[model samples]
Target chain A: MAYSATVGSVRHVFPDLKTVLARASPMRSGDVLAGVAAGSEQERVAAQLALADVALRDFLAADFVPYEDDEVTRLIIDTHDAEAFAPVSHMTVGELRDWLLSYDADGTAIAALSPGLTPEMAAAVSKLMRNRDLIQVARRIRVMTAFRSTLGGEGVMSTRLQPNHPTDDPRGVVASIIDGLMYGCGDAVIGINPATDSPVATIALLQMIDEIRETYEIPTQSCVLSHVTTSITCMERGAPMDLVFQSIAGTQAANAGFGITLDLLAQAQEAALSLKRGTVGDDVMYFETGQGAALSAGAHFGMDLQTVETRAYAVARAFKPLLVNTVVGFLGPEYLYDGKQIHRAGLEDHFCGKLLGLPMGCDVCYTNHAEADQDDMDTLLTSLGAAGCTFFITVPGSDDVMLGYQSASYHDALYVREVLGTRPAPEFEAWMQRMGMVGVDGRVRELPVAQHPVGALAELREHAA
Target chain B: MSGAADDAGAGAGASAPASAASTEPTEPGLRVVDPWLELRRFTPARIGLGRAGDALATKDQLALRLAHAQARDAVHAALDVDAIRGALDGHEVLHVRSAAPDRATYLQRPDLGRVLAEGEAARLRSAAVPVEAKGGPAVGATSGFDLAFVLADGLSPVAVQEHAASVLRATVSALPGWSVAPVVVATQARVALGDPIGEAIGARFVVVLVGERPGLSAADSLGLYLTYEPRTGRRDSERNCISNVRPPVGLSYEAAGHKLATLLREGLRLGLTGVGLKDEGPSLGA
Candidate 1:
């Protein structure tokens, strides 16, 4: 194919947005001609980069669409390393363009520039470039590919196994976890919402999950989604606590359900830290939130949903949460109302959360009353996975017996792992391999479902029969 | 760009961004050729509508404004008792209202939406309907019926005006051997209002079909709530809610009615309605 045809084939998908894309396309620059004409590939690439800088003047003059409160751009600009990035600072736009072109195949070098020049600064400079420049430069900026930065670490997809029990009974809990982990879940964490609100019940439930992890020698985290006070009480009482769990809204008032304030959140963090339970790392807060929470809690102050949702991230960042999920469809239908809105809200929330620097997760779920079905959640989950979502909640039959709604299933997690090349967190991945659930080929095994009524239920069934 | 391109290309339609935070090209008034225009001709969902400067074109904006007005009007619109009565072929009917006297009050104070009018509760209290031996009633035994329904002009009266009677009349025949209470046609009422009316009528099972909040795509949508034994202060989990009742796009009235009938029949059989019961059992194809 001709060069124009090759690019045009990609452009044909969004033919209407051509003009908008053209502004971003490096093809609009003839400076690549220098590369095309040069004697060596290296020199040609250099010439192309030089021309990209020459085209920067046009980008500086081009009219652009305005963003409302672009925090990403601000971060890049705010953290520019003038001394370390003197190479970038002193170079002309043309020279800088060539320099960035050189790293098109190298992610580590691209990541290295973040501290030296800042991601926000690199992003700001890239903003002025054409589409070709944007795509070329954008492809290289992968961060923390080797280091496990608290989240399932970089370069892998993960899920938190949420095996909720109606009574938080060991039987129900054990059955669901066996099913989920066998299908290769719990890479992110194995969290559960306690059926009973009592601290004793909640603590027992936490211990139960912890015991299972120990029994199987599973390298995963456990959480009980009762109030933070319950987790804190358990921590203080020497219970096996992995992640401190809470439901946070955008504002203090919205957090009333969790009985949370920044101070209380801080106190909970201190308490959880005192427990010293996180074996992997100290980052152990798990917060679940949704869009209309602030507005429903009467703390929106008329701010837009997406804008207000980002503020919740500030709270997440404060605790340095291990996982932050926006339960987009769990809120009432009045807020999201339908499949399309739910899908849009999930993406917007993910984008905003990821931009605000959090390992964002989504409960791609809906209720019986909602106009949405599993299909909508699938679309959102697939999109989020491609966009680098860290985790999601899994259910046994895709239904939360106690919470009374439906979410992603164990089937969904296996499907994500199969399709997206995502896996449970790295440490957990090794455990799955050791257990022979994960193949040497890196595919999760389709293990047969465990017979339910195990643990307490098994004894009851045995006695009754 | 044609209106069709807007819908099909929403996510796929980003161009190379400008130097600033601008996502759109600097060019103004120049139209770009749209590839998804043909695909866009398929759905009426706000796709592919061309843009004017920064906002929607005049025609699109006006249509949107019109839809907004229509939805608002549906919320504030009053119930037509005569039209409703004309549509129904029921056992009996009683017209009452919620405590919120007007639409404005109902919008502002949701607490009032849950209760019946001052004398309305008394009417239910006073009206004694005979019942079968279906484990008696949970609340008002002598006053309530075996099963009751409250048709409320919830968020959108337009939905009730259009769908309620047709749906109820169709579903009634499917419900066999049960002594259903007189249908309560309520004004400015919410789901919980059915509980008090059911309590007054001494109903064992209650279902409320009310107008759902309108979405940008569908305005005249309806919602239904089914409770095994409903009463005041009952939590939402105690009831099984079925929503998005409309036509051509949403859950059709017939399907909604069938689902309601199935839940009620099952609830009566199992002596339950809400949490712990799954709708997965014995699908009535509702």
Candidate 2:
């Protein structure tokens, strides 16, 4: 059926629900490249207006990708929590937005409603929200998870110490890890993006990090961001793995492109669980998502990029992951185009993921080809910090030599922690305190490397060797 | 670099308890040198740089900014057409522009970069005719050349300027008696630009040598894309890519050319390029 909206003497028509949702999205280059973007500003505003009145229940009836054709669509329909969604089931998309921002929709209320809200409903409501609205609504909701240390609480922000190397050099990776640890980073997890995507290389890196964790007794988890299949292979070889990591997407086809399936992810999760690696909680999966992944894979099924990205959160939601990060701006200029688009997309991903009951973080990063810089990242970092994002990917000097992109530096995380008045995970905070790295105020102390016992460069040499 | 050395010297001597000033702890404006700074020899990653109160030291920050600036410049830099044409003086070359009119448009609208501008396709189609076709039944035009090479100034034009011509020269030298078409140099182009160019030339295969997106450490990394039975609207799944083709830091010109030659030989023999063809030739260990 056609959807129509009349605005000031101009009447616009959209062919179907998918068209309405696609046209209603904020302008992004990927949407334009897909040939589904609104033709003009007038058409865009009209679509948004038409989308505002869409009943929340309408999303259940209109399958963007057919339920039979896609496992993601089937997952959304099969696992919905009707009891949690009872309160807002009658609300329109605009009404849902209003209700989310209302005084009554506190943390507890939103947490209860998370399981009931489908990805499409959350995406529709996000479309009607401004940047401030997105942040304001998201800040009130908290989705906490844990493995060795608890994450996501009031006045808490964590950092993923990403010590990536060009050739997966063990010394280089260990050196960067030590650099971040000195700054009181790596609370969320110490993950690596291995240069070589092979099982042998992955096992070597995993064993190295596992040795570090065991020797230091740091209260944190570790992951090697390889393919789920590779992680499974490592598991079969009895490699010391903490969190099973994979790059997931919104559509079934996109996940297939990454050589993954829902069943494979479930199997990997069970394998990780069988190891009994967690100390605090059982959430063991670590997922990395981005907006243009499905579109880039050519598996978006003619849906808008943002909406498709939201669907990926549903996949993460089902897994009960400890960390779900949006690697924004890494897709380059064709998907986002500029700093403004990346910044906005980062917030939207966080908000939608949090709304769907998932622990949401962001890799506030950019490639050289994208029209973005550290200043833009600082803006997104500050904004997401205020919005209570769970964690961020922090590297040495903010340069990922392996991936060839810039992300939040270990110092950048410190800057955010200082300015936002937030602290790290409680367990990791206590460990840092024990090492004299952070003071009583939970702020990292300014200790000379020669005086501080663990701050000495000799410690790294001993560890790496 | 000297300052770092001085700091290292100071750090070593201060811990010896020889100077009374050492008891007072680190002085203001002095960087607390990371003891593991010497470990930087193991990898190129920026590690063990001492910090100044939860921030990068002035020297390290400046070094990072310089690298970032070089990478950004590489991304926006224009392909040096005259120099490339000069480098390939002995070989026939054809120059054309994509539908994208300028650099900014080329970056934002990749769709425009995949198709030729008005009349550019006609020029390529007309150029497809072999000299013998003027006398015969146009069999060479229908059968087409064995392969066509395209040089596209993708994200990092610096890569194209530095390594594209050299790699192309090495690749052509490897294949003798092959009916290779006049090399097409496209500005404001993407990988798929080779598809339409190949289709117009009626070539059996198209090999695109385009500049890869610049990374902070390596600004001039070239990428090679090969497509068999090239045509418009081909999915990326139908093509094979050999990435990071820059010397010393990445795949060298000789190795990259050798690998491409192997793929072309294998692709022609296998009747495909994408998933069907695997680069099982001598591995490029670098």
lDDT tens string, model 1, A255-290? 664477767788988887777766657777778877
Give the top-scoring candidate (DockQ): 2
- Residues B1-286, candidate 1, lDDT per residue (tens digit)? 0001000000001111111111223358754333223212221223233324222456655554454455456656788988888787545678998888876556534567888878887887656555544444342234346678788887777788898887786566666555677888988787788778777777888888887755333446777788777789786678887766777566776787777777776676677878855665464432
True-contact fraction for model 2? 0.55
The positional error of residue A34 in candidate 1, measured at the CA in angstroms, is 56
Candidate 1 residue-pair clash tally = 26
Which regions of candidate 1 deviate over 4 angstroms?
A1-152, A449-465, B1-92, B95-183, B187-189, B192-286
Against the true chain A, what TM-score does chain A of candidate 2 give?
0.98
C-alpha lDDT of all candidate models, in order? 0.58, 0.83
Considering every candidate listed, which one attains the maximal lDDT? 2
How do all models score by TM-score? Answer: 0.52, 0.90
Supply the TM-score for candidate 1.
Answer: 0.52
Best model per TM-score: 2
Which residue pairs in candidate 2 have backbone atoms (N, alpha carbon, C) closer than 3 angstroms, thus clashing? none
